[model samples]
Target: MEWQVWLSIAGITLSTFLARSTLLVAGSRLRLPPRVESALRFAPACALAAIVLPDLAYVQGVLQFDLHNARLLAGVVATVFFALTRSMTGTIGLGMCAYWALRYLAGP
Candidate 1:
Protein backbone atom coordinates (compact mmCIF):
# COMPACT_ATOMS: atom_id res chain seq x y z
CA MET A 1 0.00 0.00 0.00
CA GLU A 2 2.88 2.37 0.90
CA TRP A 3 6.42 2.78 -0.49
CA GLN A 4 7.99 2.60 3.00
CA VAL A 5 6.20 -0.67 3.82
CA TRP A 6 7.28 -2.24 0.52
CA LEU A 7 10.88 -1.12 1.09
CA SER A 8 10.89 -2.54 4.61
CA ILE A 9 9.48 -5.86 3.42
CA ALA A 10 12.06 -6.07 0.64
CA GLY A 11 14.87 -5.27 3.08
CA ILE A 12 13.70 -7.96 5.49
CA THR A 13 13.38 -10.56 2.74
CA LEU A 14 16.83 -9.79 1.36
CA SER A 15 18.43 -9.90 4.81
CA THR A 16 16.76 -13.18 5.70
CA PHE A 17 17.76 -14.78 2.39
CA LEU A 18 21.38 -13.63 2.76
CA ALA A 19 21.60 -14.81 6.37
CA ARG A 20 20.23 -18.28 5.58
CA SER A 21 22.20 -18.65 2.36
CA THR A 22 25.47 -17.69 4.04
CA LEU A 23 25.01 -20.60 6.48
CA LEU A 24 24.37 -23.11 3.69
CA VAL A 25 27.08 -21.76 1.40
CA ALA A 26 29.72 -21.89 4.15
CA GLY A 27 28.34 -24.79 6.16
CA SER A 28 30.85 -27.28 4.77
CA ARG A 29 33.81 -25.06 5.76
CA LEU A 30 32.34 -24.00 9.09
CA ARG A 31 33.39 -26.08 12.04
CA LEU A 32 31.67 -26.08 15.42
CA PRO A 33 33.15 -27.34 18.66
CA PRO A 34 31.93 -30.73 19.84
CA ARG A 35 30.25 -29.13 22.83
CA VAL A 36 28.44 -26.60 20.67
CA GLU A 37 27.34 -29.30 18.24
CA SER A 38 26.02 -31.42 21.07
CA ALA A 39 24.20 -28.46 22.60
CA LEU A 40 22.70 -27.45 19.28
CA ARG A 41 20.95 -30.81 19.13
CA PHE A 42 18.67 -29.69 21.92
CA ALA A 43 17.79 -26.40 20.20
CA PRO A 44 14.73 -27.77 18.45
CA ALA A 45 13.30 -29.34 21.60
CA CYS A 46 14.09 -26.22 23.63
CA ALA A 47 12.48 -24.00 21.02
CA LEU A 48 9.39 -26.24 20.96
CA ALA A 49 9.14 -26.22 24.76
CA ALA A 50 9.63 -22.46 24.84
CA ILE A 51 6.64 -22.06 22.53
CA VAL A 52 4.30 -24.81 23.79
CA LEU A 53 4.97 -24.62 27.54
CA PRO A 54 3.81 -21.01 27.79
CA ASP A 55 0.47 -21.76 26.10
CA LEU A 56 -0.13 -24.81 28.29
CA ALA A 57 0.76 -22.89 31.44
CA TYR A 58 -1.17 -19.69 30.73
CA VAL A 59 -4.70 -18.76 29.72
CA GLN A 60 -5.87 -15.29 28.68
CA GLY A 61 -2.57 -13.80 29.97
CA VAL A 62 -3.12 -15.38 33.37
CA LEU A 63 -1.09 -18.26 34.89
CA GLN A 64 -3.32 -21.24 35.61
CA PHE A 65 -2.16 -24.30 37.61
CA ASP A 66 -5.44 -25.63 38.93
CA LEU A 67 -7.52 -28.68 38.09
CA HIS A 68 -10.17 -26.49 36.48
CA ASN A 69 -7.66 -25.54 33.79
CA ALA A 70 -8.43 -28.07 31.08
CA ARG A 71 -5.30 -27.37 29.06
CA LEU A 72 -2.99 -27.86 32.01
CA LEU A 73 -4.80 -31.03 32.98
CA ALA A 74 -4.59 -32.38 29.43
CA GLY A 75 -0.90 -31.51 29.25
CA VAL A 76 -0.26 -33.56 32.36
CA VAL A 77 -2.26 -36.46 31.01
CA ALA A 78 -0.40 -36.25 27.73
CA THR A 79 2.97 -36.13 29.46
CA VAL A 80 2.14 -39.26 31.44
CA PHE A 81 0.78 -40.99 28.38
CA PHE A 82 3.91 -40.15 26.42
CA ALA A 83 6.11 -41.41 29.22
CA LEU A 84 4.22 -44.68 29.35
CA THR A 85 3.61 -45.39 25.66
CA ARG A 86 6.12 -43.21 23.81
CA SER A 87 3.64 -42.58 21.00
CA MET A 88 3.38 -39.09 19.54
CA THR A 89 0.08 -39.69 17.79
CA GLY A 90 -1.47 -41.36 20.82
CA THR A 91 -0.28 -38.56 23.11
CA ILE A 92 -1.85 -35.89 20.88
CA GLY A 93 -5.10 -37.81 20.53
CA LEU A 94 -5.34 -38.47 24.26
CA GLY A 95 -4.47 -34.89 25.13
CA MET A 96 -7.21 -33.49 22.90
CA CYS A 97 -9.71 -36.02 24.21
CA ALA A 98 -8.75 -35.24 27.78
CA TYR A 99 -9.09 -31.49 27.22
CA TRP A 100 -12.47 -31.86 25.53
CA ALA A 101 -13.77 -34.23 28.21
CA LEU A 102 -12.62 -31.97 30.99
CA ARG A 103 -14.25 -28.95 29.38
CA TYR A 104 -17.45 -30.77 28.59
CA LEU A 105 -17.72 -32.27 32.06
CA ALA A 106 -17.01 -28.91 33.66
CA GLY A 107 -19.87 -27.42 31.58
CA PRO A 108 -20.43 -23.84 30.39
Candidate 2:
Protein backbone atom coordinates (compact mmCIF):
# COMPACT_ATOMS: atom_id res chain seq x y z
CA MET A 1 0.00 0.00 0.00
CA GLU A 2 2.89 2.34 0.77
CA TRP A 3 5.24 3.79 -1.89
CA GLN A 4 8.22 1.79 -0.67
CA VAL A 5 6.28 -1.47 -0.68
CA TRP A 6 4.93 -0.76 -4.17
CA LEU A 7 8.42 0.06 -5.43
CA SER A 8 9.80 -3.14 -3.92
CA ILE A 9 7.08 -5.24 -5.53
CA ALA A 10 7.60 -3.55 -8.90
CA GLY A 11 11.34 -4.03 -8.69
CA ILE A 12 10.97 -7.71 -7.88
CA THR A 13 8.48 -8.23 -10.68
CA LEU A 14 10.64 -6.42 -13.21
CA SER A 15 13.74 -8.29 -12.12
CA THR A 16 12.10 -11.69 -12.41
CA PHE A 17 10.57 -10.89 -15.76
CA LEU A 18 13.83 -9.56 -17.15
CA ALA A 19 15.80 -12.53 -15.85
CA ARG A 20 13.36 -15.01 -17.39
CA SER A 21 13.20 -13.17 -20.70
CA THR A 22 16.96 -12.96 -20.91
CA LEU A 23 17.21 -16.71 -20.47
CA LEU A 24 14.51 -17.33 -23.05
CA VAL A 25 16.20 -15.06 -25.57
CA ALA A 26 19.57 -16.70 -25.04
CA GLY A 27 18.11 -20.22 -24.99
CA SER A 28 16.83 -19.74 -28.53
CA ARG A 29 20.39 -19.86 -29.79
CA LEU A 30 21.98 -21.90 -26.98
CA ARG A 31 23.03 -25.50 -27.44
CA LEU A 32 24.11 -27.44 -24.41
CA PRO A 33 26.54 -30.37 -24.46
CA PRO A 34 24.76 -33.70 -24.74
CA ARG A 35 25.85 -34.82 -21.29
CA VAL A 36 24.78 -31.54 -19.73
CA GLU A 37 21.41 -31.72 -21.47
CA SER A 38 20.94 -35.30 -20.35
CA ALA A 39 21.79 -34.33 -16.81
CA LEU A 40 19.38 -31.44 -16.85
CA ARG A 41 16.59 -33.83 -17.88
CA PHE A 42 16.81 -35.58 -14.50
CA ALA A 43 16.52 -32.32 -12.53
CA PRO A 44 12.74 -32.34 -12.21
CA ALA A 45 12.43 -35.97 -11.13
CA CYS A 46 15.30 -35.63 -8.65
CA ALA A 47 13.90 -32.39 -7.28
CA LEU A 48 10.46 -33.90 -6.91
CA ALA A 49 11.90 -36.94 -5.13
CA ALA A 50 13.92 -34.69 -2.82
CA ILE A 51 10.82 -32.80 -1.76
CA VAL A 52 8.37 -35.69 -1.63
CA LEU A 53 10.43 -38.64 -0.40
CA PRO A 54 11.07 -37.44 3.15
CA ASP A 55 7.42 -36.84 3.87
CA LEU A 56 6.46 -40.16 2.42
CA ALA A 57 9.15 -42.09 4.22
CA TYR A 58 9.29 -40.27 7.56
CA VAL A 59 6.97 -39.78 10.51
CA GLN A 60 7.53 -37.29 13.35
CA GLY A 61 11.24 -37.17 12.42
CA VAL A 62 11.52 -40.95 12.33
CA LEU A 63 11.66 -43.36 9.45
CA GLN A 64 8.40 -45.24 8.99
CA PHE A 65 8.77 -48.63 7.29
CA ASP A 66 5.93 -50.52 8.91
CA LEU A 67 2.68 -51.61 7.30
CA HIS A 68 0.84 -48.83 9.13
CA ASN A 69 2.85 -46.29 7.17
CA ALA A 70 0.49 -45.65 4.31
CA ARG A 71 2.95 -43.49 2.43
CA LEU A 72 5.55 -46.22 2.47
CA LEU A 73 3.03 -48.76 1.31
CA ALA A 74 1.94 -46.48 -1.48
CA GLY A 75 5.52 -45.83 -2.47
CA VAL A 76 6.14 -49.55 -2.74
CA VAL A 77 3.08 -49.99 -4.87
CA ALA A 78 4.14 -47.10 -7.04
CA THR A 79 7.62 -48.48 -7.39
CA VAL A 80 6.34 -51.83 -8.50
CA PHE A 81 3.91 -50.19 -10.90
CA PHE A 82 6.72 -48.12 -12.34
CA ALA A 83 8.91 -51.17 -12.85
CA LEU A 84 6.17 -53.21 -14.45
CA THR A 85 4.25 -50.57 -16.42
CA ARG A 86 6.93 -47.98 -16.97
CA SER A 87 4.14 -45.40 -16.96
CA MET A 88 4.50 -42.30 -14.87
CA THR A 89 0.80 -41.50 -14.87
CA GLY A 90 -0.17 -45.02 -13.90
CA THR A 91 2.40 -45.14 -11.15
CA ILE A 92 1.18 -41.89 -9.59
CA GLY A 93 -2.44 -42.89 -9.82
CA LEU A 94 -1.88 -46.35 -8.38
CA GLY A 95 0.32 -45.00 -5.63
CA MET A 96 -2.23 -42.44 -4.52
CA CYS A 97 -4.94 -45.03 -4.59
CA ALA A 98 -2.85 -47.40 -2.53
CA TYR A 99 -2.04 -44.67 0.01
CA TRP A 100 -5.64 -43.61 0.48
CA ALA A 101 -6.89 -47.15 0.61
CA LEU A 102 -4.40 -48.12 3.28
CA ARG A 103 -5.14 -44.99 5.25
CA TYR A 104 -8.87 -45.59 5.28
CA LEU A 105 -8.85 -49.34 5.76
CA ALA A 106 -5.96 -49.70 8.21
CA GLY A 107 -6.25 -46.44 10.22
CA PRO A 108 -3.06 -44.40 10.33
Candidate 3:
Protein backbone atom coordinates (compact mmCIF):
# COMPACT_ATOMS: atom_id res chain seq x y z
CA MET A 1 0.00 0.00 0.00
CA GLU A 2 1.03 3.59 -0.68
CA TRP A 3 2.20 5.88 2.15
CA GLN A 4 -0.76 8.20 1.47
CA VAL A 5 -3.22 5.33 1.98
CA TRP A 6 -1.51 4.35 5.25
CA LEU A 7 -1.60 7.94 6.47
CA SER A 8 -5.26 8.27 5.61
CA ILE A 9 -6.06 5.05 7.48
CA ALA A 10 -4.13 6.24 10.54
CA GLY A 11 -5.92 9.58 10.51
CA ILE A 12 -9.31 7.95 10.23
CA THR A 13 -8.55 5.54 13.06
CA LEU A 14 -7.41 8.34 15.37
CA SER A 15 -10.42 10.52 14.56
CA THR A 16 -12.85 7.68 15.09
CA PHE A 17 -11.25 6.72 18.39
CA LEU A 18 -11.34 10.31 19.66
CA ALA A 19 -14.91 10.84 18.52
CA ARG A 20 -16.17 7.72 20.32
CA SER A 21 -14.03 8.09 23.44
CA THR A 22 -14.91 11.76 23.96
CA LEU A 23 -18.48 10.81 24.83
CA LEU A 24 -17.42 8.29 27.47
CA VAL A 25 -14.74 10.58 28.91
CA ALA A 26 -17.08 13.54 29.23
CA GLY A 27 -20.30 11.65 29.88
CA SER A 28 -20.37 12.64 33.52
CA ARG A 29 -20.24 16.35 32.69
CA LEU A 30 -22.62 16.33 29.74
CA ARG A 31 -26.31 16.71 30.46
CA LEU A 32 -28.72 15.94 27.65
CA PRO A 33 -32.32 17.15 27.56
CA PRO A 34 -35.05 14.68 28.47
CA ARG A 35 -36.37 14.66 24.92
CA VAL A 36 -32.91 14.06 23.50
CA GLU A 37 -32.27 11.20 25.95
CA SER A 38 -35.60 9.62 25.15
CA ALA A 39 -34.88 9.84 21.44
CA LEU A 40 -31.38 8.44 21.86
CA ARG A 41 -32.88 5.36 23.50
CA PHE A 42 -34.27 4.25 20.14
CA ALA A 43 -31.05 4.85 18.23
CA PRO A 44 -29.86 1.22 18.47
CA ALA A 45 -33.07 -0.22 17.06
CA CYS A 46 -33.14 2.42 14.31
CA ALA A 47 -29.55 1.67 13.37
CA LEU A 48 -30.21 -2.06 13.32
CA ALA A 49 -33.28 -1.62 11.10
CA ALA A 50 -31.37 0.66 8.73
CA ILE A 51 -28.72 -2.01 8.26
CA VAL A 52 -30.89 -5.12 8.13
CA LEU A 53 -33.98 -3.83 6.31
CA PRO A 54 -32.18 -3.26 3.02
CA ASP A 55 -30.69 -6.77 2.98
CA LEU A 56 -34.10 -8.34 3.66
CA ALA A 57 -35.93 -6.13 1.15
CA TYR A 58 -33.51 -6.43 -1.79
CA VAL A 59 -32.53 -9.47 -3.84
CA GLN A 60 -30.34 -9.63 -6.98
CA GLY A 61 -30.14 -5.84 -7.02
CA VAL A 62 -33.96 -5.58 -7.06
CA LEU A 63 -36.46 -4.68 -4.35
CA GLN A 64 -38.60 -7.69 -3.35
CA PHE A 65 -41.55 -7.69 -0.99
CA ASP A 66 -43.48 -10.79 -1.95
CA LEU A 67 -43.80 -14.36 -0.73
CA HIS A 68 -41.01 -15.48 -3.07
CA ASN A 69 -38.39 -13.65 -1.05
CA ALA A 70 -37.14 -16.01 1.63
CA ARG A 71 -35.23 -13.41 3.63
CA LEU A 72 -38.19 -11.10 3.81
CA LEU A 73 -40.46 -13.93 4.83
CA ALA A 74 -37.99 -15.07 7.46
CA GLY A 75 -37.71 -11.54 8.78
CA VAL A 76 -41.48 -11.31 9.04
CA VAL A 77 -41.66 -14.62 10.86
CA ALA A 78 -38.85 -13.60 13.19
CA THR A 79 -40.59 -10.31 13.90
CA VAL A 80 -43.83 -12.03 14.80
CA PHE A 81 -42.00 -14.59 16.92
CA PHE A 82 -40.17 -11.86 18.77
CA ALA A 83 -43.32 -9.83 19.29
CA LEU A 84 -45.14 -12.78 20.74
CA THR A 85 -42.33 -14.18 22.91
CA ARG A 86 -40.03 -11.20 23.57
CA SER A 87 -37.09 -13.62 23.39
CA MET A 88 -34.01 -12.54 21.45
CA THR A 89 -32.59 -16.06 21.44
CA GLY A 90 -35.79 -17.58 20.15
CA THR A 91 -36.16 -14.87 17.52
CA ILE A 92 -32.70 -15.51 16.06
CA GLY A 93 -33.06 -19.28 16.16
CA LEU A 94 -36.50 -19.22 14.56
CA GLY A 95 -35.45 -16.63 12.00
CA MET A 96 -32.51 -18.70 10.79
CA CYS A 97 -34.61 -21.84 10.80
CA ALA A 98 -37.29 -20.12 8.75
CA TYR A 99 -34.74 -18.72 6.31
CA TRP A 100 -33.04 -22.08 5.82
CA ALA A 101 -36.29 -23.94 5.47
CA LEU A 102 -37.64 -21.44 2.97
CA ARG A 103 -34.47 -21.58 0.91
CA TYR A 104 -34.41 -25.37 0.94
CA LEU A 105 -38.06 -25.54 -0.07
CA ALA A 106 -37.49 -23.07 -2.93
CA GLY A 107 -34.82 -25.40 -4.40
CA PRO A 108 -32.22 -24.50 -7.05
lDDT of each: 0.94, 0.88, 0.96
In terms of lDDT, the best-performing candidate is: 3
TM-score of each: 0.72, 0.53, 0.71
Residue 7's lDDT within candidate 3 is: 100
Instruction: For model 1, give the 10-residue run with minimal summed lDDT.
Output: 19-28
- In lDDT terms, how accurate is model 2? 0.88
Instruction: Order the candidates by TM-score, highest first.
Output: 1, 3, 2
lDDT of 2 by residue, 2-105 (tens): 99999999999999989779868777588888999889989999989999889888978899878888888899899889999999999999899988898899
User: Which should have the higher TM-score, number 1 or number 3?
Assistant: 1
Off by over 4 Å in 1: 1-21
* RMSD score of candidate 3 (Å): 2.8
Query: What are the per-model numbers of colliding residue pairs?
Result: 0, 0, 0
Tens digits of lDDT, candidate 1, 1-108:
599999999999999999879879887799989999899989999989999888998989999878889999999999999999999999999999999999999999
Off by over 4 Å in 2: 1-22, 26-41, 59-66
Better of 1 and 3 by lDDT: 3
Clashes of 1: 0
- The alpha-carbon lDDT assigned to residue 31 of candidate 3 equals 92
lDDT of 3 by residue, 18-107 (tens): 988989988779998999989998999999999999999999889998999999999999999999999999999999999999999999
